[model samples]
Target: MNKIKPGDIVVITHNTLPRLGVVLKVHKREDPTKDIARVHLAKHNKAYNFLISDMEKIIDKNT
Candidate 1:
């Protein structure tokens, strides 16, 4: 991925459920194996991380 940042609209599809989310923050993770992706969702108060493989491009509002 290029320089993805906070507020960028991204879709994170849940493996088990039909759900997509908007991206809130994109940052490097402490662990080398993981890149951090924060999402803004009303269903959950907390932000969730999805691996690069799990992320989909729906829109780029904040790009």
Candidate 2:
């Protein structure tokens, strides 16, 4: 899996409905392999932290 970078649009699936957000930061935890993604959900006007594995990069449907 490719590492998610800041500024990339991502989809968070932890809710009943998947949310779209822009990644603000990628943090490496003490575990090294356990990374976290900081995302800004514009619709909700909130920022949240989620496991990197729980988010997916949004691909353009036009491509």
Candidate 3:
């Protein structure tokens, strides 16, 4: 998987349904494998926290 960063569009799966969001912040935990991310969802106008592994970057369809 590619490294995620702020401003990247990602798909978050832990929520009620898979949703698209923009990464806001990344918090690295003591265990490197358990890094967390804060994402902003435009549709809901809200932000949520999730594990980095639970999010996948969105591939540009136009490319």
Pick by lDDT: which candidate is best?
3
Distance from true position, residue 18, model 3, in Å?
0.7
Q: Which residue pairs collide in model 2, if any?
A: none
Residue-by-residue lDDT tens digits, candidate 3, 8-42: 88998876789998888989999967999999988
**C-alpha lDDT of residue 32 in model 1:** 44
Q: How close is candidate 3 to the true structure, as a TM-score?
A: 0.82
The local distance difference test score of each candidate is: 0.65, 0.84, 0.86
**Candidate 1 lDDT by residue in tens digits, 1-63:** 554566566566657663466777676778744776777665686677776556766666653
What lDDT would candidate 2 get against the real structure?
0.84
- Candidates in order, TM-scores: namely 0.60, 0.79, 0.82
Candidates' RMSD to native: 2.9, 3.2, 2.8
Error of 2 at 6 (Å): 0.5
* Candidate with more favorable, higher lDDT: 1 or 3: 3
Give stretches of model 3 more than 4 Å off: 59-63
* Decoy 1 TM-score against native: 0.60
Off by over 4 Å in 1: 1-3, 29-33
